[model samples]
Each structure stands twice: as structure tokens, then as C-alpha cells.
Target chain A: MRIGLLKRHSAVFIVYVILAILILTTGLLSDVFLTFRNLENLLRQVAPLGFVSVGQTFAILTAGIDLSIGSVVSMTSVLTTGMIEGQQQLVLPVLVLVFGLAILIGFINGTIISKTGVHPLIVTLGMMSVVQGGILLYTKAPTGSVPISYDFVAWGNVWKIPFPILLFASVATIAIIFLRLTVFGRYVYATGGNEEVARLSGIKTGRVKTIVYMICSFTAALTGIMLASRMGMGDPLVGERYMLDSIIPVLIGGTRLTGGVGGVAGTIGGIFIFIILSNALNLLDVTAYWQWIVEGLVVIVSVSLYFRQKR
Target chain B: MQVAVSKRLQRSPQHIRSLFERFGIYIFLAILIVTASLVSPNFLKPQNLKDILNQSAALGMVAIGQTFVILIGGGGLDLSVASVMSTVAVIMAHNTEGQNSLFIPVMGVCLLFGIIVGFINGTLITKRKVQPFMATLGMMIIVQGIRFLYTKGMPKGEFPPIQRYLATGDIGSVPTSIISLAVMVIIALFVLRKTTFGRKVYAIGGNVNTARLCGYNIDFTIISVYMISGFMASIAGLYLAGWIGISDNWVGKGYELDSIAAVVMGGTTFEGGRGGVLGTIVGVLIVMMLYNIVLLLGMPVQMQFVVKGVVIILATSFYASFRRTQT
Candidate 1:
């Protein structure tokens, strides 16, 4: 029975093993890799994607993709910083506006997919284009600054841990619990596992999916805010790569791209693996160009591994 | 009496919906043309028409490639095509450097790269079982990175006059580019509509398992489809290099999405095996005209992106609804 269980859960098991191997390899390859400073910095850098991955986990859980996450991040970064403009007093209002816009975008995405039966990829692709254009129309150049007060969230530390890491941990914990221990979570799994069967089982599959999308955009918005805080400026192009980057972690961490077979714990491991891999590259003096090759190879290999495990 | 009239209107929407699928984009293209002529007297001039056709030729080639992959279905998409175009543009420009002696070799290399990339993409998806989206997406990222590394973020070189003439120069008052494009389209339509391979493509797209069961070499067919896509992208890249008179890393930035929009808008169902090359060309023409309209109206350049986005959403939704009704 135990052997059979291990066989079934082998993908997640492999991810953990991979994570461990990455840690050991990096540590042996670079003296600083095992140090607290490097670890903390890695966690801090992983924060934005960490949060985004949690939300992506939900979307993928429902057999849908959220391509607009990157655009949402871009829009949110622009909106938050553009509105704040270094004014501490406007931070709250700007955040509210950003989240509200994110929610609205999510609603539009979910409703259209649900009502029209158009594929989520196309719907989100359209949304990405609209948001991207909106960002350009709003400003051809990077505009506005994040308030200095917001630095606490981006750079602050508590109990020797950076706040972003703390934020990611908190979000991941709640998500893991929500997905593993709740009725709605099960519905999400059911919907993704087999939508037709889920519907016949009386699940409000549409609502479940719509809510999942909302969660996705909400987290992405939060990541954007965090990114703006870190950079202290709003740049339209900053979020262009996040959509691809976020999906990688989810896929590598054993969250099935086909949906219904993964969770937050696996995603956390995925994020760690990515962070360590990138850090290793940086430590080994790899240039930005070579990093791309390595990243692509990693995706191909990890995905292939996933398929092999399933077989 | 009011209910009867309302009922009649409601019933006509179904008629209207099908009409839109079959000819809506063409109608929109016509309306836009009329509107453009009314807005700017220069619009109907031969020079302007030539400019539009020239631009469409470059974009249309890419769309044809996109249509093929999407037609082959099974979540088929070629995200790397645009990136491949960019890389080839750089390679050709840098290697040839306006030297006629070097042109043939560079062209050969570019086409070779296209085939290699397409083969890799096909193998990754089919043999490795990576989702098509993920495979192409990974390739796109990797290729872009490689290009950046090769160019060091700055692309240099120019198209030789001979190449330039093919792209923009006219031959006896007829643009060679458009003529070439017309011939290519004719060839594509013939192959897609008349050949055994075309039938196999449709069979796999309509249902992959059924196609496999019917003894079609599913893997070979899919790989060939992507190879065609890659080759078409290389052609677009060459034309764009000549048309723009420069080679840059950013040249192919948005062609993937634009090609997808064109294919979907052309009534080629995303579910595949339902549309043809002729419709895609018309779709490309519609997109081309929309850009012209923006220029004529002097609208913010960004508004074109917005308009394109909205059009994609509306077009896809309309098609999906129509398909749903048919089923």
C-alpha cells in the first residue's frame, strides 16, 4: 500500500528531491549560496512570483490559464505608483483603486469565458492586449514613484526575515489550507478533474471558476504593488515576463498544467527550485543571454519529467 | 403585434450571426474602406492602395503560417514563429550586410534555422508530451534570449538593394511582393483544399484519436505543419527586413498575437479544421485596413491595439456562439 501510494505521488516527491538537489548543488558550487544573506535575498526576490504562483495554482487547478496576469501586474504597477506619486497619504486610495480594477478585470475575464464558452486562453490573450495597450496609452514612459512608506512592505524585515517572504509564506499557507481543507477547494479540484462530471454532481462550476479567476487577478495585483514598491517606479514593461515565469513554477512543482492534481506546497517547492536555479546561474557568472537558454532547457526537461512520472 | 416584430428580429440574429461568420469580416473590410475614402481623399489613390497591399503581404504570410498550425488543431499554436522571424531577420542582416555574394548563403542558413526550430518544437510537444502552448512559449523565450545575446541588444546591418526591390520595389508597375504573396496564397489554398496531405491535416484536427486510428502518421503530419509555419515566418522576416530597410530585435514583437487574431477573425475556428486560407487572407486585410483607418483618423497609435483586442474578443465569441448553436 505504501509503495503504491508513493508511486501515485511520485511527481511531487520528485519535485522535493529536485529542490533538495538544487540546494545542495548550489551550496557546493558557491560558498555564499548557503549563507543567510543569500537565502534571504533569494526569498525576497521570489516573493512576487511566489504570490503570483499561488493564484496561478488556483487557475490551473480549474483547467484554465490566466495570461493576463502579467498585464494585470503591469497595469497595477502603473496605477499604484502613478496614483501614489510619492505621496504617502494617497497610498491607500491608490491600492483600493488598483484592487478594484483587478477585480473588475477578473470578473470580465471569468464572465466572458463562462457565458460565451470561449477558451480561457483566447479571452485572457485579448485582455492582455487591451491592458497592454492601456498601459502604453497612459504613458509612453515610466511615470510616477512609489511612496517611501511602501518600502516597508518591499524591503522591510521582521524577526530577521524580509516582509515579502513573510507575505508569501502567509499567502501560501492560507492557500494551501483553503485548497486542501475546504469544500470550495474540492469543487475546484472536481471541476478541473472532470468538468462534466462536476456539473452533474451539482457543483456551481461556473461560479467556482469565476471566483478562482478573481483570486488569480487579486494575487497578481498584489504582486504588482509589491514590485512597484521594490523598484520605486512604475514601468509599463516590467511585468511583460511574469506570465511565463509564473507558469513555470506551477508546472515544475507538480501542479498539472491540465489541472486538478496539484497544490500550494508543491508550488512553494517550485518557486524555491526556480530561485535557486537562477541564483546558481548568477553565482556562476552566467550572462542574461545564456540564462534564457538554461531557463528554456529547464522548462523542457521539467515538463518531460512530469510526463514521464505520469506514465 | 410588438411581440411578433420582436420575435422576427430575434430570429434574424441567428441569420445575421452565420452571415457574419461567412462574410462579416469582408463586410467590415468594405465598410472600413468606404469610411477611409470618405475621411481622406488620398485613401483610394493607387499609391495608398499599394502601400496597404505591401504591408498586408508581409503580415499575410505570417498569418498563413498561423492558420496552418491552428488548423492542425490539438491545442496547436506557434508562439515561437515571431521570435524565429526576429532571429532570422538579425541573422540575414548581419551575415549578408548588403553583400550580394553573401545573400544566398545567409538565406539558406535562415531557412535551415527555421526548420530546425520547428522540428524541435514538434519533437518537444509530440515526443516529450509538453503542451503545445508551453513548448512554443518556452521556445519563444529561449529564442528571444539567444537573439539578444547575439546582437547584444543592438541589431545592425541593412538589406541589399536586390532584396529591397523584392520587398518594396515594383516590377513594371506591379509590386513583386504582392504578386509573390498572391502566388503563395494560391499554392496554399490548393494544397489545403485539394491534396491528400490537406485531408490528413483536417482529419487530425477534427479528431486526433480518430485520425491516429485511421492510420495517419499523426506525429509526422503535426511536425510538417509546424515546419510549414516556421518556413512561412522566415519568409515574412525576409520581407520585413527589406520593407523596413533595417534589421532589429524588436521587428517581430507582436506578430504571434496579430497572426492569431487574424486567423481566428477569419472564421477559422480555434477548435480547428473549420476555416481556410482565403478567409485568413481576408482577415489579414481587415486588420491591415483597421491600421490604415487609425492612421487616417490620426488616432492615438495605442488605440489601434485596443481596437484589435476588442475585435479579437468579439470575433472569437461570435464564432464560438455560432459553433455552439450548430452543435
Candidate 2:
């Protein structure tokens, strides 16, 4: 059993080793790379990615991908600011409505996917278009401001640690526990491994699928809230990159694209790797265009690791 | 025997599904055109109608290329088409600088870029065991990065006057764009339906293991499909640039999704094999009509996107359900 556990965890262990090597090299590139200020900024950047990937972890563990999460985050960002409109009183109500809408979108995605047996990519791709269009129709340009009072979500520090890090840590901790110590989580694994077998065993696989989408989108909404707080305004395209970026961390952290294996524990290291690499590249005076090239290579390399690990 | 035949007729679910698969797009097209005409008189005008077809030719080319990739199955697609198109367009405009003489050289350069990008994507997927989605998406970012490096985030120059005229100029009442589209269609149709390579593609899409056991070169077939897709994207980039007549780095931003949507809507299953280019042309028309109607009605671009998304969901679900029944 101990050997089996080690075999299961070996992929994540490899990722952390990469992370350590990357940090050491990047830290040596410049004095500021290891500075407290730089690490705080890095944590803030990783926080939103962390939120989305946690939800992504749920979706992937069930052999599904939510392409619409980026749009969900985009909608949440705009709605959070547009409704709050620089006022404290509206924050609670606005968040309730935003999260409700996010859940509904997820529910719609889940229903079509489960009922029709259509590929999740196509369904969520459509949802992405619809939601993006809705945001544009609402306002083509970026609009809306956040109340300064809501800054705690993204900017506040607790016990000398940045609030974003704390929030991400808390969320990741809860998620890891839920997946590791829950019946529904086991059902997720079973469904991913073989839905026909799981269903034959009397598990409500459809419900599990729907709930995973909901959890995924709910976390996206949370990321949106954090982003809106950080940016101090709503931006329609802010979450545009999350669609692919979220998947990178999940894959890098050792989650299998084919599903039924891996967990969020690995994704934490993946997010850090992504943020640190990006941050380090910037610190090294790499141009944005070149950065994109490097980032592209990173996506392929990390994602391709899954296929190799299976072999 | 008579009783069995009659009983099968009574249980006509498969028959209904096949009918839906065969002519679903035609019905959808007719309805969309009728609705569009009713929405605005301008939609029916010869001039406006010509413009619609002319504009669709640009996107239609890209969609046809995507259909090839989609036909490869296992969720294979070229997400980098948009980036490829934009990069090619930028290269075309910048290199030509309004000179017709440079056209051949520019064409060669643009198509070559497409081939290289496609080769890289194919190699990643087949040789390195990378997922098609991620491989192409990564290639997309890499291409975009390269484009920005060349154009410096700002585009310069324009397509020569001859190219513009060729694009927008019509012969008598017919548009040149339509003629170009016909040539492309014939080429695509011939390659997909007539050639041995085409059959191999179908075999692979139907089942990779079976194809492999039969001694088909999986790597070569998949690589060539991507090559064809990339080559088409280059042609589309040039075609669209002639229409716009201006350089813009962001020209190809949304084509990937829109082209995939159009292809999927045209009765082509995403799982690959079993759909042809003719159906995809109709699907392109349906999407184009939607854009035209939205334009004629003064609807915002956002409305077009929403309608496209809703239609894709509706259309794909219809197909998906029928597919499930057959299985």
C-alpha cells in the first residue's frame, strides 16, 4: 500500500522538483526575484489562477473540461463591479446574484453535456461565446468600479501573509480535503474511470457530473471576485486567458487529461510554477512577445507530461 | 419477411436520425434565410446579398480547412488558424506594400509559414503524444507571439489595388470571391472524396487501432491533414486581407471559434469521419446569413455572437442526441 501510494504520487513529486530548480535558477537571475515584494505580487497573480484550477481539477477529475469558466470569470468580474458600483452595501447582494448566475450557467452546461452526450469542449465553447457576447453587449469597453472596502479579498494581508495567498490556501485546503475524504469525490473518480461501470453500480453519475460543473463555475466566480477586487474595476476581457491558462496548472500539477487520477495537491505546485516562470521571465527582461513563445512551449511541455507519465 | 419489414418501418428512429443528419443543415439554412429576409428588405437586395457571399468566402475557406482537422477525430482541431490567418495577412500586406509584382513571393512566404506551423502542430500531436487541443492552442500563442514580434503590435501598409479589385470586384452580376470559393471547394472535395489519402483519413478517424493494423502511416496522414489546414488558412488570410485592404494584427482573432462552430453546425460530427465539404458549405451559409441578418437589422456584433452560440448549442445537441440513439 505504501509503495502504491508512492507510485501514485510520483508525478507530483517530479513537478515539485522542477519547481525547486526553476525557483533557484530564477532567484539567481536577479536580486529582486527573491524579494518579499516580488513574492507577494507572485502570490496575487497565482491566486486567481489557483481559484480557477481548483474548479478545473474537479472538472478534469471527472473527464470533462469547462471551456466556459473563463467567460464565467469574465461575467463575474463585470457583474461584481457593475452591481457594486463603488458601494459597500451592494457587495453582498451582488455576489449572491453573480454566483447564482454562474451556477445557472454551469447547470446549463452540465445538463446539455449529461443529457446529450456531447463533448464538453463544444458545449462550453458555445457557452463561452454566448457569455462573452453578453458581456460585450452590456458594455463594449471596460466599465464599473469596486468599493475600496472590498479590497480585503485581494489585497489585505493576514498575519503578515498576503490575503490572496491566504484565501487561495484556504480554498485549496478545503478542496483537497473534500476530494480526499468524501463519498461524492469517490463517485467522481469512478465516473471518470468508467461511467458505464459506475452507473451499473448504481451511482448517480449524472448528478455528480452536474455538481462538478457547478463547483467549477463557482470557483471561477470566486476568481472573478478576487480579480474585480484587485483591478478595482471591471474589465470584460480580463479573464480571457483563463480558459487555457487554468488547464496548464492542472496538467502541470499532474492531473491526467483523460481523467480518474490525480488531485489539487499537485495543482498548487503547478500554479506556482506558472506564475514563477512568468514572473521570472519578466524579471529577466524578456519581451512580452517572446514571453508568449516561451509560455506556449511551457503549455505543450507540461500537458504532454501526462501522456508520457501514463506510459 | 414482410412482417419484419413492416415492423422496422414502424420503429423508424434510425430512419429519422439519418434524415436529420443528411438534410438538417438545408432546413436550417432555408429557415434562417427566410427569417433574415423577413427581418429586413435589404437582406434580399442583389447588392447586399452579393456582399454577404463575398464576405463569407473569407471565413468559408478557413472553415473548410478546419473540417479536415476535425475529420481526423479524437477531438483534433486547429485552434491556430486565426493566428495563422492574421500572421499571413500581416506578412502579405507588409511585404507587398501595394506592389503587385511581389504577390508570388508573398504567397509563397505565407503558405510556407502555414506549412511550418502545421508541421510543428502535427509533430507535437503524433510524435510527442500531445493532445491536439493543447498542441494547436500552444502553436496559436506561439504564432501570435511571432506575429507581434514582426509587426510590433502595429500593422503597416495594405494589399495592392489589383488584389482588392480581385476580391471585391464582380464580373457582371457574379462576384469573383464566389469563383475563388468554388475553386477551393472543388479542390477540397476532390482531395477528401476522390483520393486514396482521403479514404485513409476516414479510416483513421473511424478507428485508429484498425487503421494502424491495416498498415496506414498514421503520422503521415495526420501530419498531412494539418498541412492542408494550415495551407488553407494561408489562402484565407490573403483573401480576407484583399477584402479589408488594410493591415491589422488582430484580423484573425475570432475565426478559430467561428470556423469550428460553422463546421460543426454543417452536419459534420466532431468525432471525425462521415461528413463532407458540401454540408460544411451550407453550414457556412447558415452562419453567414445570421451575420448578414444581424448586420441588416443594425444589431451589434455581440448579438451575432450570442445567436451563433445558441445555434451551435441547439444544432450540436440535436446531432448529439441522434448520434447517441444510433450507438
Candidate 3:
């Protein structure tokens, strides 16, 4: 019985082991890497991606991807920063507007995909471009700053835990519980596993898909707001990297491309594993060009192992 | 009435499908030309038409290769083709820098590299049974990384003079690139129409399980298709390098999406086994013309992406509806 449990949970086990190795190696290689300040910095750096990955887990578990997340992030950042722009009273309204926009984009993606039966890749690829363009055109590269009070809400630490990190943890916890204990979550997995079977079983497959997309976009918006607060500035190009980063953690978390399995806990581990590796490489003063190669190699190796294990 | 209806249905032979298919391509081309002309007066001008054709030439090459892969179906996607183009262009540029005699040798190297990358992609997808999306996505990342590393984030070197001429020179009011494109299209059309390998491609994409049962070399066809795609991608890269007169690490970025979009818009079903090079040429022209129209409207660069994205979805929806009615 114990061995069976171990076999089924091997993905998490592997992730933990990898994280441990990365942490230990980084500690040995650079004095700065193991310091409290550096650790705090790393936590903050990974916080936005952590939020995005939680949302991505929902979409990927439904056998769909959210390429619009990065653009959504950019849009939210620009919207929030532009609206508030040092006005403390407008912060709440800006957040609401950003979240609303996220939901709108998500619904659009879901509706178009489900109604048209077009592949998610094509749908989201189009959305990515559209959203990015929307943000750029609307903002017109205007420079703006977030209000200080909102920054406090976004960047303030409670007892040494950064607000963003705490937010990420709470979101992750909620996601894990939702997946493990909710019927909607089970439906999501079932739908991804076999769409026809799930539909025949009377699941509201369309609603489930639509909701997941909404959640993915919403989280992306939330992450963007947090990032805007952290940086105190809104830049159009800021969210460009999240599209790839979000997927890397989800893939590393052992989610099959065909979908239906994996959870946020494993994804958290995967996120840390990537963060630590990248952080360590930076600490070692690796060239930025070489760093890209190493990062790419790492993702390839992790995914290759995933396929090998599947076989 | 019943007898007449039955007779009409029966009289339409399988050959009718071919005729209908040919008609669809022509109709689509006509619609594209009319729409572009209606949208902008400058769209039909000879210079603009030549520009559209020149732009379409590179994308069309990549789309032709994409047609082969998609024809094989099985959720196959080649997202790394653009990255491969960038890498090949950089390699070719670096090797042939300021050397006239070395141009052909450098191009030979680029072609070989393209084949190797395509072979790896094929093996990973077929032999390893990786999902085509993930495999190609990973390869995309890897190649992009390698490109960045090779160029160290900055592009250096220049295209050979002869190579540059191939991209920029005009022959009797037609771009040299267009001539090259025409030759490639002819070769591709010949291969598709007259070769056994081409027949096998359609057969495999039409129904893989049946193709396997019939003892077709499924693996070989898949690999070769990817190899052909890679080779075409490299050639496109070389032309881009020559045309632009400079090579960058980011060259060909987002081109994979454009290529896939053109192929799908060309009436090639994502489900596979139902497209031709002729439709792809029309598709390429439509895409290039759309870009030119947007530029003519003086739209901002950012809005161009939005328009392009909307056009892709709209085109796919249009084709989807058209196909549904036919079936």
C-alpha cells in the first residue's frame, strides 16, 4: 500500500528533491544566494509567476492553455496604473475594473472556443495578439505610477512574509482544496481526460471550460496588479515573459499535455525549482545569453523526463 | 422528382470533388483581391502588388512546409520552424561574412542544420511519441536559446553580395525573390501531384490507422515532411537576411504563427488531409495583402497585431462555416 502511494506521488517527490538540490547548490556557490535579503528578493521575484501558474494549472487541467495571460497581465497593469496614478481613492475601483476586464477577456476566449470548436491554441494565440495590441494602443506608452497606499497593499509584508508571496500561498491553497474537494474540479479533470465521455455523463462541460478560462485570466490580472505595485510603474512589456514562465512551472509540475491530472502543490514546487535554478545561475554571474540556454535546456530536460516516465 | 434527384446525386462522380476543390481556391483568391481593392485603392497598384508578392514569398515557403506536416495530422505543429529560420540565417550570415566563394558552402551548412533539427523534432514526436505541440514548443525554446547564445544577444556579420542580390534584385519588374518563390511553388506542386510520396502523405493524413494497415511508411513520411519544412524554413531565413541586409537574433520571431495562420487560412483543415499548395499561395497573398492594407491605413504597430489576430480568427470561422455547409 505504501509503495503504491509512493509510485502515484512520485512527481511531487521528484520536484521536492530537485528543489532541495537547487537550494543546496545555490547556497554553496554564492554567499548572496543563501542570505535572507536574497531569499526575500527571490520570493518577491517569483510571486507574480506563482499566481499566474495557479491559474494556468486550472486551464491546463482542462487540456487548454491561456496564452492571453501575459497580455491580460499587461492590460491590467496599464489599466490600474493609469486609473489610479497616485489617486488613493481610485485604487479599489481600478482593481475592480481590471478584474472585470480579465473576466471579459476570459469569457470571450471561452465562448469563441467552445461555440466555434476551434482549437484553444488558435483561439488564445489570436487573443494574445489582440490583448497586447489593445494595451499598447490604449496606453500609447504613457508613463504612470501606482498610488502609495495601493503599493502598501501589494508590497507590504506581514511578519516578514511578503504580501505577494502570502497572496500566492493563499491562492494556491484555495486552488488545491478546490481541485481535491469540489465537484467542479473533478468535472474539469474528467472533461480534459475525455470530453465526449464527460459530456455524456451530464457534466456542464462548456460552463466548466468557461469558468476555468475566467479563473486563469482573473489570476493573471491579479498578478499584474501585484507586479505593478511592486515595481511602482506600469510598463507595457513587463508581462511578456509570464506566458512562458507560467507554462514552464505547469509542465514541470507533471501535468500531461493531454491534461486531466496534477495540482497546484506540485506546481508550486516546480515554480520554486525554476526560480532557484535561475536565481542561482544569476548569482554565479552567468552571462544573460548563456542563462537563456541553460534555462531552455532545463525545461527540455524536465519535459523529456516527463515523457520518459509516462512511457 | 425523386428519380431526378437520385439521378443527379448518382451522376456526380468522385472526380467532382476535385473540380469543386479547384473552384474553391479560385473563388477565395477572387474574394481576397476584391476585398483588398475595396479596402484601399493603393492595394491593387503594381508596386504594392509586387511588395505583397515579395512578402508572401518567404511566408509562402514556410507555409508550404507547414502544409505537408499538417497534412499528416495527429495534432502535429511545428512552432520551432521560425526559430530554426533565425538560427540558420545567423549561421549562414556568420559563415559567409565578406567571403564570396563561401556563400554556397555556408548555405549548405544551414540546410544540413535545418535537416538535423527537423529530424530531431520528428524523432521526438514519432519515435518518442511526444505530443506534437509540446515537442515543437520545447524545440522552439531550445532553438531560440541557442540563437541568443550564438549571437550573444547582438547580431553581427553581413550577407554575401550574391545572396543579397537574390533577395533584393529585380528582374524585369519582378523581384528576384518572387522568381525563387515561383520555382519553389512549381517544384512543390509537381511533388504533390505526380509523386508516390505525395500520395502517401495525403493517405496518411486522411487516415493514419488505415494507412498503417496498408503498410505505408508512416514514420518515414512524417520525418521527411518535417525535413522538407526545415529546409524551406532555412531558405526563407536566408532570403530574409538578404532582404533586410542584416541578421538579428530576433529575426523570424512570430513567423511560425504567421505561417500556420496562412496554411490554415488557405483552406487546409486542421484535421488534416484536405489542402493543396495552390490554396496556400492564395492564403499567403491574402495575409501579406492584409498587412499592407493595415500599413496603408497608417495604423499603429500595436494595432496591427490586433487586426492580424482578429483576421486569423475571422478567417478560420469563415472557412469553418464554409466547410460545414459543404459537408
Candidate 4:
């Protein structure tokens, strides 16, 4: 009877099974696969994307998408590194200003989308171009570096655990609580589930949507800062993958891309699955080109499964 | 008879609105042209005009397909178009080995490949119940991966002269590409206006359940729309390869965005079932002109993105207000 109940909400369960199989296979195939050091490194590797996916969770929960999240991340990275300029004393102030700017961009995106009734995809795509172009115009190439002191956010650990993993866990925990416990979080799901019904029920659907998009962009900005700290330098092109990559895990985690039916728990499993898959491929020394094929197939199969499950 | 009478009775206000919507893009295009000529003497040069038209033809072709899909309106979009274009170009280059004789067979293969891709996309959306955006996006990724593997991350071969002639060759000073674009647009306009299929597309876009009750083959129509999109994308890919005389992985990198912006700017609401190829052509020209003006003003390329963003926002707001007033 308990197992039957578990099966009913077993999207996360299936993901765990797949993840375990992946880990087991990799552990058997490679000598270094199960090492604590390597596993820790993999967790750190997934952190930036993990953060962005959390943001996507909110946006998708609200029935809109932030295509500009990747661009915002890229721009944030550029601005952070540009402002920090390797000056240790400048990191804090510069980061504050960058975050402020990112939030402002998010606000503009939210306002335009909600007020004008423009499709979120188009609005965010336009914003993506603007941000990317602005970054390119500001620095034709990678131009500045963050201070070395900031490396702890990307690399350093407390009590043998990586800081990024710690950061991701806390953020995920907060997100879980916000989604499960808060009125506003429920409003987001309500808004996505049926905007008209939610509105008639006294929810400010527009505001909910705008705030969700803002949160999405804000997290993306945070990711950019982390990436900048990790690389020690900002490259204008680094965040391009986030546009698609961030959304993939959310979908794979059984969060409906159409919106309103899933949460962050599945996302964590999705992240682990992807990180482990990539790590296994790396261990197998698969060519990069073939890896693309594998990743694409995985997304297609998982999405097909999700659609079937929904039906 | 009652329906006809009501449509006739409602025609006056609708006529004025439709007239404005149809011709408004032309007015906007004319204004941009006048401004460009005034600001930059180079803009009026016959060669430059031809260059602009030639450049827009490829994008215009893709936008026509986008118009068809958007016209059907169940969140119909083919993000895979750009990826399809890139993969077709890579296949052509690899198969032809840059030999002029093999170009014809390779072109046939490209079209076949497009049909296969379109079939997959259409099937996924209709039969599998996948969202159009997600299905096409998945197709895009898959095609991109295929292209990468096929080219081994580095493509080789020069585009054939026969293909180049399609883009640059002229008949009585009119570029062949522009001429082909005009023919395609004419055929498209005729189909959308005069054919049963066109009516079905509009009917579906305007109201799916009603169309289904009225016995329209909704699934088939939707699939055909995607098929046309794939076909158009292949043609655009050929033009791009010929114009650039190279086969590269990112050949169609920005076409999906550019085509969407063009379709929207042409006054096709996201709600669908409105607008036509003429407006899309105007939209494409306007965007190309904007790029030209930015270049003439010696602005950096990055400014173009800002300009495009602002234009989209303003146009969308304008349409939103217009809809409000109408309501």
C-alpha cells in the first residue's frame, strides 16, 4: 500500500533509479568515478546550472519563460569582472551594483511583458539580444578579472564540502519552503494553472507573473557572478548555453514545460542525472560531437515520456 | 446566408482596420527608405538597393513559412527551421563535395531531408501531443547535433557556382534571388487567399474546435504547415550557402529570431489568423534597412540589437493599444 502511494508520485523515484543506474555503471567502468574528490567536483560543476534551473522553475511555474536569463547571466559576468578588475576591495561593491543592474533589467522585462501583453518568449528574446549586444559593445573581448579572494564561492569548501554545493542546497531548501509553504508561491502555481481562474479568485496574476520572472532573472544573475568568480575572468560568450541548458533539467525532472505541476525536488534529481551522465561520458572519453547527440536524444526521450505521462 | 449577411454588415469598420493593417507596413517601409536616402547618399545607389533586396530574400523566404505556421495559431512555430537550414547546408556540402554536377542531386537530398524533419516535427506535435515549441526545439537540437557529427565540427567545401548564381546572378539587373522571392510570395499569397487549404488554416487558427466540427483535417493541415516551413528553410539555407560561398556550422544561427521578429513586426499578432506575406516582406526590409542605417551612422554592430529590441517593444505596445481601442 505504501509502495502504491509512492508510485503515484514517483517522477522523482524514476529519476533516482536512473541516477543510480548511471552511477553504478560509471563506477564499474572507471577507476576514479566513485572517488569523493571527483564526486565533489561534479557537484561544484552543476552549481551554476543548478541555480539557473531553480529560477526557471519559478518562471515555468508561472507559465512564462525567461529566454533572456542566459544573456542576463552573461551580462552579469561581464559587469562583475569588469567592475572588480582584480581589485580585492572592489568585489563587494561591484557585485552589489551588478545585482542592482540585473534586477533592474528583470524589472523592465517584467513590466514590458505584463503591461503590454507581449508574449514572454518574444520579450525575453529581444532582451536577450539587447543584453548580449550590450556586453559585446562594452567589451569586444574578455576584458577584466574578478579578485582572487572571491574564489571561495566557486572552489573553497567548508568542512570538506564545496561552497557551491552548500549554496545550491540552501537555495533549493529555501525554494522548496517558498513553494510548499507560502501564499505567493501558491499564487505562482495558480497563475500558471489557469490565469483567468486565479484572477477571479482575487489573485494578482500579473504581479505574480512579473515577480516570478524577476526571481528567474535574479537567480540567473547570481549564477553569472558565481561563474565569474570561478573562472576568475569574464568571457562574454560563456552564458549562451544557459538559455537552453537551464530549461532542460527542469523538463527532465518531470516539471511540465507547459507549467504548474512540478517543483524543485525533481529538478535536483534531473541535475544529478545530467551531471553524472556528462561525467560518465567524460570518463569514457567520448568525442564531444557524439556527446551532443546523446544529450539531444536524452532530452527528446525524456520530454516524450513526460508528455505521455501527462496524457 | 445569415452568416454572409452578418459578415457584410460588419465589413465597414473591419474594412478600415484591415486596410490600415495591410498598408501600414508599406507606409513604414517608405518612411524608412526616405529617411535612409536623406541621411546616407549611399542608400539610394541601385547596387545597394539590389544588395538589400538580395539579403532580405533569404530571410523573407523563411518568414513566409513562419507566417503559415503562425497563421495556424496553436502555438505553431518551428524553432527547428534554422537548425534544419544548417544541417541541409552541411549535407549538401558534404555530399556534393563542391562538384557542380552533384549539386542537383544534393539539392534533391536536401529537400528530402527537410520533408523527413518536417514529418517528425509534425508527428511529434500532433500525434504525440507535444507542444509545438518544445517539439520543434527538440528537433532543432537533434538536427544541430547531426550537423555537428556530420561535419566533425569542421565543414569543408566551396558553394557551387550554380548555387551562387541563384543568389547573385541577375536577369536584366534584377537579382535572381529577389525574383524567386517574388514568385514564392505570389504563390503563397494566392494559396492563402484563394485555396481551400488556406481557408482551413485561417479557420483553425481563428478557432480550432469550430474548425474541427466543420470537418477540417486539423492534424493534416498542421503537419503541412510545418512541412512548408521546413521546405522554405531549406531554400534559405541554399541561398545563404551560395551567397557566402562557404559551408559552416552556424550558417542559419539567427534566422529563427530574425524571421519571428519580421513576422511580428509585419503586424501578425501572436493570436494568429491575420497578416500576410506582403507585410512580412516589408518587415524583413525594415529590419535590413535598420541594420543598414546603423552601419551608415557608424554605430557598432551591438547597437543593432538595441534597436531591434526597442522596435519590437514599441510595435507590440502599439498593437496592444490598437486591440484595446477596437474592443
Encode model 3's per-residue lDDT on B1-327: one tens digit a residue.
Answer: 457545655865543453444355556668868987887898889988888888888888888888888878887768888988899889977877757799998999998988887898888878877667667777777888788878877778888899888988998888999999999999998897789999888888889999999999999998898888888888988888788878788677778988887777777776678787878888788777767878977887677778878877776665565454445
**Model 1 docking category:** medium
Cα lDDT tens digits, model 4, B255-320, are: 987898788878776667877778888889988888878887889988998787777666656555
lDDT of 1 at B170: 89
Q: Which pairs clash (backbone N, Cα, C closer than 3 Å) in model 3?
A: none
Model 2 alpha-carbon miss at residue A15, Å? 2.0
Candidate 1 local lDDT, residue B271: 75
lDDT, candidate 4, A139-203, per-residue tens: 87876987667888899999989999899999999998999899998998898888889999999
Candidate 2 chain A: 10-residue stretch with minimal lDDT: A302-311
In terms of TM-score, how similar is model 1 to the real structure?
0.94
Q: Interface RMSD values for the candidates, listed in order?
A: 1.5, 1.4, 2.1, 1.6
The deviation in Å at residue A271 for candidate 3 is 1.6
Candidate 2: tens digits of C-alpha lDDT, residues A45-164 = 888999999999999998899989999999999999988889889888999999999999999999888998877877898899889889989877778998888988999988988999
For candidate 2, give the lDDT of residue B230. Answer: 94
- Could you tell me the fnat of model 1? 0.59
Instruction: Kindly list the per-residue Cα lDDT of model 2 for residues B1-327, writing each as its tens digit.
Output: 457555765777576675666667778788888888887988889988888899889889999899899998877889999999999999988999989999888889999999899899999999888888889989998999999999988899879877887788888879988999989999989988899898988888889999999999999999999988898898888888888878999886788887887888886777788787887888788777877787788889789878877888888887767777776
Best by DockQ: 2
The local distance difference test score of each candidate is 0.85, 0.87, 0.82, 0.84
